[model samples]
Target: MGLECIRGASLAPLNTFGIDECAEQLCLVHSDAELREALALADQRGWPVQLLGGGSNLVLAGPVSGLTVVMRSRGRRVVRRNGDSALIEAEAGENWHRLVVWSLDLGLHGLENLSLIPGTVGAAPVQNIGAYGVELCDLFDSLQALDRRTGALCWLNREDCRFAYRDSLFKQQPGRYVILRVRLRLHTRPVPRLDYAPLAAAWQALGLKQPDSRVISRLVCDIRRSKLPDPARLGNAGSFFKNPLVSAEQAAAMLARWPGMPHYPQVDGSVKLAAGWLIEQAGWKGHSRERVGVHREQALVLVNLGGARGGDIMALARDIQQDIERRFGLQLEMEPQLLGN
Candidate 1:
């Protein structure tokens, strides 16, 4: 019922990368009161506070200092339901994939395309998580967060969150707000989004008479399992880099040079280039050096081949970033947050 504290906690098991590092102090808080108490305790002791969720989307760069607070709060339920529409709320600690399945079980649509993403509900808006043809912002109604600056609980709407491509207000101003829970607007009527080519093809292959959210979710899981590695078996943070967006003119030039290169045009007169394709083209796919390597199946994923340190992972990532920049004149931004210096 209170904050569970540990000193000199090993963080290797917490992160997906399994980087061996220790936090000076770690607190696992299961409720808002506990979280606030943990923060107050850290502040009183003059220890810097670092937040963590599922640990699926971060890089433990080195041994962390001060107090590390892990959000472990949990709950999920339908807040309300209207004619063919519903509003659902979930506590921060709820697993993302499980939330998707829960929604489907409730006959809710909209989250099927984002079924297999890692991390918890609290971390979703931080990265504006997206997959297949859907993004979290599409259904995000609002979220309850503790604003550190004011020490007050606040409700932030979709526009208030300032959601963008893999970005949000929570990410823009880190350490300023702690997301406590999230609310989503979903539909009871089937309105599947299969805009992604591969998803559409897989759906077509099924040849079902009508769209089924569960079936769509299964297909998504199947696709993700095939492309991404299981963190338990092979230590990895899925998709190490964000797909770079280039100007229309830049995209035209790149297309002219490599006709086979994959590109997706945005409504904002920009083109999104596949980061994995660029990395593979630069000959880094399956490339290994002692303990770290690029995943053979997914060039976007950087894997830790047992006994790899945080420094080793960053070194590989830097090499890949440099190569992609040199080869394509594009910068591949890392998707995972670096937790330490």
Candidate 2:
């Protein structure tokens, strides 16, 4: 049975940040039937529902109103298979990293490059999650979304989702649909992407000449472990700000001032500036305001050292925002889902 809808449900355990906020109502959905029932209950009670994933990419700013449906839908399976290409589908609640490892165990290649990212499989498409020169869109075959208004399940192909740099159509329409299951197109024939600067640096640093997909996966995980804080130890949303894209002329001007600026040329004739570099340039690295601070190792990540209220973290983010804008003449948008403004 699902957790009965309750008043003042503790939310500290629901978010990675471990903030002491309460949800006005709380419920869990383990299957499609229960999801529909929860939607009906919300409609009848005039209470909005907050759909929670693994709670890895969210900040609970204050006590949330209405019901929360923590997605607990479970299971992962090889939906279809061929000689080299196969369709791997996972329930929304399956741990993302676990699924990645599962695919690798099956000798699947496409997902190996994305190992160890935090959060649920369903949320992957919500932001078209990416890392280490690879992206969810690189393997995303399609997805099934449950429409909130009509309660109808519909399939969305790559074009329908409109995936783009850390964005997708579903992310645009928050609270409007539930991602039920995600399907990925993985390959048995291995091909690894190891051209990212950090990967190459790590390889050169370790005296490695060539690394396959699995080796690249392990290396990427190692690099991420060194930079990012474990959620169990510290409260943080990964990549608090998105890398800002600027015109080539603007990048040249900024390079003149900073000289050692790090960036990549986008296919659309734009330059992707590192948000971490910008934050560091603005002198916010290792900077703290009471409970919240910029992670010294990864300035792009805003961290909760201890008992940080989301508002405090947001204020620091705003400060970072102002500073980056002032310094670089470029604005960086936040990456986390902010609840209870």
Candidate 3:
């Protein structure tokens, strides 16, 4: 199907949070042309359009009142190769984890560290998704997107994207452009980044002298699986809050108080503190109120027990944010975007 539209579509299945909500209208587009058609249709009807990918990073706080377009375009290929480096492209709707595996199969490096991230390739650049010690921007080459304002497809380079720790131009200006495809620069050589303590320790335990991208990917997946709850079994987003960044002075003050709090110093003279550690230290780990609560194993994650509403989840998150501010005097920013209300 080129463009499929449904009225009063249930959004519970679209979002990983499993929030029970409905979209006034939902359109599934399988190609860039279809996507454009859907947008034109929405405009003709005077309805606001909302774009959704894997729905792994959104919260529906209320019923969606406009046209919700789901990106389902599909394609992937090796664009060109030169010596040890190669350029690869993937359609917006391809699964992120599958793309990582495909790159490894082709003996390409750089994407192995982001293995098992739950979302589409299109959504990856929006959040500049990262794991272990690698972010998408590290490997990103360029992307083709449709400028909604001008209706022209254009390419954006790395500098044009303006990626920063879990933030990007797409996120900064939501709904301005529709990403059609993404290109990443990869390598034929195995270049592993095992700076994260847990992953590095696991690698040492393996006792392997050779750097293997596939093995690194497996280890990252194992670590994530152990720490995060499966969205299939439990209704939840991967992480509820972004790790809070504070000034060097602020970090020094907190370290003096807690002494053992986990913090990573950045080159910009800022410190990235673990959001999970803060929640756990504040005694909210494994805490539940009604149908929403913090994950028992990972405090940064807020899970849906069952039959939970969007408002309930936000209320729980609000409580956690207020408590963290009261206890630590730092604000906790939510990672997922709110889709409604």
Candidate 4:
């Protein structure tokens, strides 16, 4: 069955930011066949196609004069079980938070730390979503995607995905492959990560010597709530910039300037500076001009205080980039994808 394609589709409802935009041709594809058909139609029309998952990470300023295919497909099931771990497959359209809850119910423990993060499971791999000492790649098995150029479904292993900090192969080569479903290998037994600051603090407060994955999940949810604003009330993507990683020498130099600095040592021998702290120290915290502002609770978040345009957010982001560089000599990169280039 192909997509029952429509003309003049409004994208405002599809994206979480709710910026008023329209796709010349928009599709709500429930199946991969429908997705392929929609893409084929977009190809024939010479209009570039954008694959939208939950639209939580997108910023749409004005009318998108092209084809935007929103994945409405959804499902969760165990494809195969391997001893204590099983290969769990989720359709591209499955709500990410729901999937986490479902996994917890099934006694799967790996995805617990990623609870309450927005966007569909299909889009998680693109940015390698991580929180509280866990990343999506830790439990990754493989994923299936439709290659638009070849018009064939292809399977990519973890290595093929080439995931990095807030980056993946799909994001690197955008528009080439549309993710259909993701397969994860999670442990039946708990392998909890509690090394992160907030999670550890939450555990200490709770007075638990050895906590399970569920405890970490609850802690993460509470910490995130206290830090980041709810997107429904205030329009904003989670984090606006990637935590900049600098060399040891650079870190030492920065420490010389500001002795009180928060940093985490990366696996690749680099130091990940706290982007939120940098923004807060730069005096951008709670900074608002009209509708656009940096979140008061967490400076890493940029908010749309009603009627804020995407351009306004972009300007704020640029201002942060400039300020961070001028103050600390470290450049911050955007985590969200900017539309309407």
Candidate 5:
């Protein structure tokens, strides 16, 4: 099928932030061929191409001046099953939460801890999306991507993606490849991960002797629903900032002063400080000037109350960043991808 392009498309409905903006051109591609055709059309027209998945983790600054290709392809099935382990492949545009539920419905485990994460399957690896105690890298088998520059297809393994905490090679080298599909290895035997304090506490609170993936997934969904504001109700891109990593010595020094600061020591000799706690301590929680504000429940979430412009959100984020840096002497990095100028 030929690629269909829409000019002057409103971008507010495309992004989770609901920021008012427009795209010069927008194309929804349901297959790799359509994606390639759209890219080629952009090249022929001397316009840049921007790739968009679910738009859950994006901040549209203003009107985009190029062809924005929104991936809409969808498919998922078990590619291989060997004894207790099965390999499942899903197209880039498949909803992440739906995939998690589908895996559980098929008696496959390993994705329960990552339930309720927003975005498409393709965007998961880009951020190495993680929650509770499990990350996307844990079950990742391989992924098929189309190299935009060379027009070649490449299969990248976990190591090739260079998976890190909420980051990957796909993000390090932006606009290099368009992820087409992802393969994950799941097991029939339940392997529940409740090591995270919140999950463990919730499990203990439930007074259950043992829980399956479905139970754990339900608990996680409940926990997330309680803590996070629904984007449909109040516009938000989940966590707005990445947790700041600091040296052990720095963490110790800070802890000595605060005594109650939440921190996790990594195997790499670094400490991950909670950004939400820092933001809360800096007095930004439930703070707002006009339409942009920090969520009252989750200090990490910056919300668009109503009629908020991208600049207002950015300004509030900058103010929060400056306050946190000045108070804690640590820098917080934004998690969402900011598009346009």
Candidate 6:
């Protein structure tokens, strides 16, 4: 397909935040050739390019200047299978939750714990997206990405992507590589990960000793729906802040002061502190200012009640960050990518 560009495109419909913003130019690419063509055109025009997937994890500041490329490619297939294990590949544009469901439908099990995560498959690896006790890196096999500078396709292994807690190499150097497709490995044999306390409790409450992948997926979906407001009904980018990782000493200090603070020790000896607890402790839960507010149910989520501007949301987030820092002496980093700078 040839590159098609729309001038002065409204970005509100494209992003999950529903903030009204205009992109100077917008192009939707469905294939590698089309994506390369769009990049070439942007380069020729000296326009900076921004890659957008399912805008589930973004905070648009205002009007976006230059070219905005939306990945719309689609495909999913089991590329290789062996006895109990199989390799699956999905195009960048496929919905993440849909892929999880598709895997379960085919009797695959690894992705059951990651159910209900919003955004496209392409954006998954970029964020190293995780939920429950599973992360994309756990199932990731490899991925194909297009180098914007050289217009070459490169196959990156799991290590090449440099996956970290809610971060990746793609995220480190933004606008350099456009993810085209992702390959993941799944198992036919049931490999339920019911380690997370909430999931384990839900499973136990169901009175089932051995639940299948479908059951686990359904439980995760239900749990997410109960806590998070649907982006369609209420504009939100899910969790707004990354759980801050503190050193052992720092964690000990906070633990001494609060004693009820939820924390998880990492292999590297750092402790991961729950950002939601901090926000709630700082007294921002269910807090609203005009159209933007912190979600009443989930403190991690910032929502647009009705016609909220990006500035309002950003300002509110900054205030929360400042308050949390002041109260706990810990800095919180935002999870969403901020655009239009």
Per-model TM values vs. the true structure = 0.98, 0.95, 0.98, 0.96, 0.98, 0.98
Query: Looking at model 5, how many pairs of residues clash?
Result: 0
What's the lDDT for residue 111 in model 6?
A: 96
Candidate 1's C-alpha lDDT?
A: 0.93
Model 4 is weakest, by summed lDDT over 10 consecutive residues, at 12-21
Summing lDDT over every window of 10 consecutive residues in candidate 6, give the lowest-scoring window.
1-10
What are the per-residue Cα lDDT tens digits for candidate 3 across 1-341? Answer: 45678999999999998998999999888888898899999989999989999999998999998899999999899999999899999999999999999999999998988999998999999999999999999999999999988989999999999999999999899999899999999998998899999999999999999999999999999999999999999999888999999999999999999999999999899999999999999999999987888899999999999988889999999999999999999899999999975
lDDT of each: 0.93, 0.86, 0.93, 0.85, 0.92, 0.93
Model 5 RMSD to the real structure? 1.0
| Predictions: Cα RMSD each | 0.9, 1.7, 0.9, 1.5, 1.0, 1.1
- What ranges in model 6 sit over 4 Å off? none
Model 4: per-residue Cα lDDT over 1-341, one tens digit each: 44676688877666666666677777888888788778878878898888888888888766666788888888989998878998899999999999998998888889988999999989999898998888999989999999877988999999999999899998899888888999999988888787887677778888876657787777788888888888788888889899998998899888888899998888888999999999999888999988788888889988888877778888888988998899888789999887654
List model 2 lDDT by residue over 157-177, tens digit each: 999999999999988888877
- Distance (Å) between predicted and true CA of 138, model 1? 0.4
Candidate 5, 1-341: lDDT as tens digits: 56789999998888888888999999999998898889889989999988898888988888889999998999999998999899999999999999999999999999999999988999999999999979999999999999887999999999999999999998899999999999999988898898898888988888877668999999999999999998899999999999999999999999999999999999999999999999999888999878999999999999999988888989999999999889999889999998876
Which is superior by TM-score, 4 or 5? 5
Output the worst ten-in-a-row residue range by lDDT, candidate 5: 202-211
What value does the lDDT take at residue 294 in candidate 4?
86
Candidate 5 lDDT score at position 99:
98
**Candidate number that wins on TM-score, 2 or 4:** 4
- If both were scored by lDDT, which would come out higher, candidate 4 or candidate 5? 5
